[model samples]
Target: MIEDPQGTVLALFAAFCRVGGCFMLLPGFSSARLPMQIRLFLAVAISMAILPLLWDTIYPRAADPVASYVRLIVFETLTGAVIGLIARYFVLGLQFAGTVLTMMIGFNAPPSPDVIEDTAENQLTNLISFAALMVLFLLDFHHVILRALVESYTTMPLGAGFNPQGALITLADTLKQTFDIMLRLASPFIVYGLLFNIAVGLVNKLAPQIPIYFISLPFLICGGLFLVYFGISSMLEIFAAAFIPVFEGR
Candidate 1:
């Protein structure tokens, strides 16, 4: 049976739109403020390029006029958005860790522009978030992303349909894990602050004239800076260690 070129072209364009919309919001992919038209065309070009490559794999059989085509577009778009959101959430988790860490350490420099959300994140949050995001691409973490995207095709094929129940559960799990990981990454500062504050409070009570407030604030701030400096490397390492399993199902 000969394949319909018109159907193939329509499907491919639809796929491009779906994928491009996701990339528009995805971290690192569409980092700049490119207009939607340009972004869409870029996505379509890439999709066209890949469509030829995945012709046998992705090409759908033609059915009755109009119904399946609309379904294809909607389903593909939703799935694409879901995939992009999942990947972006992990990056947000990393950003969350940085924000919490900075807040704890008194290092936040807020109101700086953010490439991810295209507004402004706290400067410290922006730094760490950008660095972590770069690391993901540097390490070719997209390999994992692409693997998931491919697996999605097999696990939830083109016409397999959406499952609200499964999506909700997975989204909840991702958010929960994201929060847990952020806390774990920044827990050191929280612990240090807690203990240090307790000691400072006690010292103040015991020696009321010791100039504790001014004296201790500098000491506390310096101590926090030093701890963060020492812990930064380990922080990234810890994130990397825990991050793999979350997406990899390891």
Candidate 2:
């Protein structure tokens, strides 16, 4: 007997909801402050467009109509979210570094437009985050993510049992790797803060009346800005290298 079209569509819609929920929280695609409805539409559109192509290979023909559909939605959403989040992890590294650099350079806590729900990041963090995002896109990191999704189908197929521990491990590794990259990204600024402050301290100690510490802020800030501008290319290159493996495979 032919499967009910209404049931199939409903099943697809359910799958879309789960996938879109993951996208709603994932980075890059959900980075904008667009209305929830618009984001929902985009997510569903992506899912629907891909469904026809991958339906046979991935989405099971609706059978039980209850448990099977539920499992399909859950697994599909988890996979999409995992892929999206892997990319987000890399982006967070840059953001973390920027936050530190900004604080060190006395540029912390500057006003910034809200880009996500519940809060806004510092302007410096936002800038670095945006730049890193561009670099990731330039590297076709999204393609890599899509590839990973394709690979995930083999490791964790739709309607299969969820792998909670594996997902946890992946997420944990992403967070750990992000922190490592952020430290590397912020190294120059950290060094600048250290040596620059040390030099100012020495001068202040020597001449007590010179107020060298106060006088050096502008020089330090300008020098830091220049260094960052010159170093960003290299920084992003390193980031790309670090990001490739996470999206590529196990």
Candidate 3:
């Protein structure tokens, strides 16, 4: 019943290159704890599922004898990697913001294993990043990334070479947008730390004998924790809302 089995197989592998490339760097899927076998199969399965929808586009490019199949494979992989990196960069930006927030608020607890990755991170940073990531999962943010992957065929069709300059521009834009949002989220804590430190410095200046540093640290931690408790909901809301636009390159 099937015609051109060779071409079909070639097309499927081409699809896999792209899908697998995306999953290679995708946030949750790319975590160290996720087995490579599971990642491979999921990429293959998605490639198979999407191949039919993109059959016309991928098959022609893949089946052509002169089309440099190896080149096509490389291009497809890079294209998908670029898309995945955009999302990854945004999440990394949030994690960076969490680190800044912790430093600003004086939450210098011992570093522990990250909830999502293998790296050691401040506990508060771990909490904020993990909560944000979990919220994104709950909101099904991966669905948006999938939609983008599906739509990418039209923009960067099979056999079309990867555009490094364009990809760089897109990633640069994502960083800019991500930095803006993350900075806004952490601004309150930054201001709080600045004001608190200034006051403590003045009090120390007035009372040169007292251990002002030790006295102020507890208050700093307590106030920072209180602010986090009250503001966390809004911070997560803002983070989730900004994700789609940033990922979509809007």
Candidate 4:
């Protein structure tokens, strides 16, 4: 009994283009540990659930000529990818901070496969990134992302022409903000490493025969671990709190 079934199918496909594009790059959901089929199914399910709310805006656009539909598919995919990368960048900042932390603390564990990405990463970096991502999941970050996606229709309606310049600017701004936060989180360890190395250098100079550098390595590592033990909880707390604000451009 459905009239204009083709239009409905096209509209559903358009919705899938946006939602699936987002999931393709979303942090936790897009992790390498997740199978591609599962991610695809999840994206399809989410698109279906939200299609009703977006029908009026999307269906009319879908009813346009085939060429128009193709253009919409491209534009919507790019839009969703941009939105997903905004959140992904913030989560990546935690990994950046972890790498900096590991270097500053002198913990050079061998690289291993990362749970999130296919690339190999330092163990500490992997641990921190995993923990922070888990915390965000516990906080229901996906719900925030979905709400933002729904609201995005107002700001970036269907069939709007793509603005590469605007997307680039947004990406640049997000990088700057995420990097600033990472630096702040890692600053203490940076300072500690600098001062500790300087002191170790002086000790080595004063007693050239003594292996002061080697002797101090353990102490440096221990001190850094202690600092992380106390600061990690707070660090992840701040990171989790920033996700929604950063992604929403607030």
TM-score of each predicted structure versus truth: 0.85, 0.85, 0.98, 0.97
> Mind giving the per-residue lDDT tens digits that candidate 3 earns over 1-250?
7789999999999999999999999988898889889999999999999999988999998999999999999999999999889889988998999999899888898899988889999999888888988899999998998899899999888888999999889989988999999999999999999999999999999999999888899999999999999999999999999999899862
lDDT per model, in order? 0.71, 0.71, 0.91, 0.89
Q: What is the lDDT, from 0 to 100, of the residue 134 in candidate 4?
A: 92
Better of 1 and 3 by TM-score: 3
Candidate 1 pairs with clashing backbones: none
Q: Following a full C-alpha superposition, what root-mean-square deviation does model 1 have from the true structure?
A: 3.0
Query: What TM-score does candidate 4 get on C-alpha atoms?
Result: 0.97
Candidate 2 per-residue lDDT, tens place, 180-211, comes to: 77798899899988898898899889889997
Better-scoring candidate (lDDT), 1 or 4? 4
Q: What would the per-residue lDDT of candidate 1 be over residues 93-132, giving only the tens digit for each residue?
A: 8887777767666564557877666787877677777777
Q: lDDT of candidate 1?
A: 0.71
Error of 4 at 1 (Å): 3.4
Please give the range of 10 consecutive residues that has the lowest summed lDDT in model 1: 58-67
Give the best candidate by TM-score.
3
